[model samples]
Target: MGVRALMNDLTGSKSDKSECWMSLRAPELFRVMEKIDKEYALVRKDAQKYIEKIDFNKRMLEVVLAEATVAYQEVYKAGPLYARIPGGLPLGGPCMMKLPDTVLFFHRMKLRNDTFLRVNVLHNDMVNMVLRAHLSVYGLHLKGAYDHTTTGQVRGTLVHTPTAGELGIFLEDIKYTIEGRYRFMGDRLVIELIVSTLSIRNMALKYPNATDSDPPVRLLKKNMADFRTGLKTDLDKWVQDYFNGYLIVADLQDIPSLWKLREYDQYKTSKLAAFTDLAVARINKRILDIGGDYIRVPKFKIVAAYGLVINIYDGALRGLDTMYRRSVATTVFKRDNLRYVDAIIGFKDLEVSYRYVVNFPPGPLMPPSLTGVLRMSAKDLTAHLSLGLLMDPEVVELDINFINPPGPDDITIEGAANILMSNFKHILRYEIATIMSNSLMYGVGLLRTLPRCEPFVPGMLRNTTKLGKFNKKKTLSTSSKNSDEARSKESNYTRPQRRHGTTVKMMQDIGTK
Candidate 1:
């Protein structure tokens, strides 16, 4: 009677149209349609929120990327590449000879050129004694009066020059050079040097039993080459002994604003959290194979492939000096002072293997990745020309486990519980990848700033201050001025004394008259 009857009167077909109107009025049908409408609206709202969330995450990532780029540039600008080795030979520098016999020399020497290291052997009594004892068979005399010229070169007359045969050996000049790679063995830093070149001159044999059969030029060449080869062998041995059993310490500074990012407004913090979650998820999914060890990121591949192993035991976070005393494990933190975030990390033994490729195949070779070509071998010329490089794929294996801390500045039981609840491994992996990638890039920039060649300067071997002589002269002048003033004052007082004595003499004469 209600809407159904009205629809029937209008259409003039009561049966068909009436049933349609009646179906529309049913409660069950009305409920189903309403439920579908409500669900559709809710889904539409959720879809809009999801799109916005994605856009927000993208913006947050962009900000982090920009900051990382700037930090990288700044690290490079700060000059990390320069070698921190002493610029010149310091006084009392330690030196030791390794080849024929182990002998320690007291005198320090400085590098003059790549092939020349200037040393004062004759003046150093200990060095001279050792050389005379060892080099007597070669007719070389270390005991001789020598003059240090204004140019800092040692010039002297040979003591055995007259006694030696017509073609005697003369030590024309002694120099040294460093010619090996700087590398790491276990936890030690090592470097070796070898006598790659030598300079010698021939002299007439003056002794009675001098052999005339051997040509002077040929004899000199043979003797000098032998001496150099022997010296190089000794030097290699000395370097190994010196650096053996030594530990290298790596000090890394704390990040100042790492934890502050969490204290932002609700919207901003939420966006950052989403971004971090996604980043962690992506890293965990990769499961990269580095050398033999599986790691979360590929950047660590360089360390494994290149024998650069980070020994955590040798490194300490300087800011947490007090924390280390409490517990070695507790030294690593999740957050500190509401401003710093720490990623707990553990390292396994690092393995690096290298192979040089001298020859290339007939067909074209595949291009290498960024981590693959970090170091190129100069020995492979064919590989360089044909395939753009010459080295076997370096195998690096480093096993690492990252542990997440509970909260900001929390290192107690509650924090540990929190870490267990939140997927700690995933969070730690993300944090480590972020920190290490930036560190590696920064290190490369630093290496680029090192000087290509040793700097050559006369007084570089010693701490020769320019103002030393001037300061001495100034002191002498001031002392002389004070003495002159005292002398003038004494002369004036002596004249007055004589005048007073003359008056006394006149008074005595008047009394006698």
Candidate 2:
């Protein structure tokens, strides 16, 4: 109040015309101007902080853009245009999501190549026997040898044309629709080709147990065969009706008698269903014996895809006693060019042990003794590839270098243990390396010799391509009951369980009918 009164007095004291106008201003106007200045100061402080934050965000965005540019350039420099895609290797494990049948692109898969068909021994004979039994199950008996060769050589040709990415395979005497599904595990691609539907093309002429000697039997056979020949539709439904109504349900009691003459219980099992099942089991057993159940894809193929392939499956390199101990291995390309690509394998965490015997001729208080556990741990081990024009891949050079070289501390034994340990490690290192190389080569050799036409059938009849061989002598000789029983015993056959209960239902329907 004192200051305001003093300021009023001063304005009143001024009598000049210009000074008199200043005295006319109210006190409320000065208060309002002061309030506006205080508000502006608070807002200016907050606005400065916001500007700094904006600058920081701009710098971060620029850095991200620069990194993206470099990544794009490197990918451009990589192999093909497809390789630049997200699923490309070194990082793209299997890259399977891009396509249905294959990872990137799988053009075609043909089973029996006519130009270079490599049919295995006995494939034909097994096929013919199985077909004969299958037809017999449906009461369709073809007279004179049910020779498959007359129609086609059981030549299973799988043709995948450009029109669709479908796989068509001819499994000797039977026809089935196949579908493929795939998955990625670590660095490998596993494709499961499964049967979607079952079908039959060639029909039978005569009903089971029908004899050619009888007039009605001969007439029945002729009429059925002729009727089947004229029909241009799928025979599955017709065969099902024929089997359920006339063949199996009516002759259920006579099954034993009918098969008795055929010697069908080759497996010696009480659960023998039909001669067809027995033949199927025999073929399954044979495949198991030959190690066709599990097929390890040649690692080189994966190597080419990824450029660097890592396999935790130590089995391939386990042939070497020492190499078997420390198991992780990686196959990588050392160099790549238009002429050729150089690949090498690198091993990690390698540890090998050896045993030695030292002889000290009765010196003072000593005798011959054996030393235990002379251990050597390799710091690094590498192998170079030497591939020629062969179906298999091979490693030519193996260099084993230790991170911690062998020291006296490695041996606990007393007398000339150092000398023995040194010699042992030296020989063991190279021996293991050589064995590991050969082991890898052996696996590749199998991949080369074994048919690449399809994945090996994991189980007999379960996942079979049904492609097989034919032989008139074998088929005819094995038809007798005594021969079938003897063969079944030899085969140790097991009846396969149908995945879909379609057959069981069909049988039930037939019984009801």
Candidate 3:
């Protein structure tokens, strides 16, 4: 009948034999066996899921690894999150975390490298002037040219109300617009991307801004609905709804003259940035979630990033059209998959009249004055780099201008290509570890498969390896052509009798001359 009764019956009727073992032991062996089975069941349930899809999408593991690198860059930039040791500016300053002048150490020091160092935050006095000029150009009259401390807007606001139509704010100075190939939608901003703009807009500008609120975006004080709306997914909808505009007048005049501007700077940026980042991230995630092939994915990311930028310029077009042409943010990269992105949050080259001041020490003498603002060729003129490729652990190794710096004499297309190819070969040989693709793409290694091929294996890498996965820049035509030729079993596609500019040619160049 029951298990225990059955056991006793079977034992029989051997109850005396079973009783002797039980008498010797403190714990029953069956009880231990039952506990072990229960433990294993739980472990099996937990482990089965991970093991089943161990090599599937793989993002769960990659996300962890990738995010750490970003976190490290952030921490490393913020301070020596890695290891901070103190020294002066030249000696170890670049490597050191803190400056001689005291302040809470940042998780990362925003080392803004610009085409021109003077315009970056390396000096404070320059940035202030850039802001003041931006204010004057917009006629926000927010701050006076001579006085750096005045945070109030009094110019035309003194004479009249900033009618709802005045909500005009924009960036006209950024590179994509400045280079003059971009367009502006009359009702709302829509940045048209261009090829030349990839490195400038997507690399330089975005990285500086991305490093957690340094210049602290100053979009507003009280409400951030504007920033949110500006960041909405459907740019077309905003165009339809806000065909008429709204001018946001900060009651800056409400504050006293003695009050400082920096008091509000950090807070103001915090509010606006939260709105922008949330909206951008939301839109990007949605676009990626509805995925297509690799080709379609990057376009969605670029489109989302550009939408924010174009809207900023379009919003401020009311006044910006004066000193600046309507601004635009362009997507670049000959290949669709490789373009750069950043919330073209705004693009006006900021130009300001500035005086650097340092506070003097108190005693027999006070700490002398030191102050300045970031100066640029223009106000709000910035290039931002935000894109999916950036998230890949593959390090970026090229910049547009550097690859082909302008010569005193103009260089032809062929010459430029030669320069680029040389640099590319050099970088490939050394700088790159992961030449990127949709997944964790890597280079060919020296190994091959077992004969049975239970799972296909890697073949050996030659001393001069040519086999590798395509990068974002590689084209479908190139790949298809290669595949077609491979099907034909063609091995002599590349002839090496003599050449002038190829990698093999380079050896020839070096050998002859």
lDDT of each: 0.21, 0.24, 0.20
Candidate 2 off by > 4 Å: 1-339, 387-513
Model 2 per-residue lDDT tens digits across residues 79-144? 211101111111101000111122111121122221111111111011001111122111122212
lDDT of 3 by residue, 75-193 (tens): 43554211121111111000101111210101112211111101111110111111000100111111101100111132101111111111112222222111111122322222232
TM-score of each: 0.16, 0.16, 0.16
Query: What is the model-wide C-alpha lDDT for candidate 2?
Result: 0.24
Against the true structure, candidate 1 has what lDDT?
0.21
lDDT of 2 at 147: 9
Q: Output the worst ten-in-a-row residue range by lDDT, candidate 2.
A: 88-97
**By descending lDDT, how would the candidates be arranged?**
2, 1, 3
**What lDDT is reached at residue 101 by model 2?**
21
RMSD values, in order shown: 39.8, 39.5, 31.7
Q: Per-residue alpha-carbon lDDT of model 1 for 360-432, expressed as tens digits?
A: 1233452222111112111111000000100111111111111111121211112222323242232222222
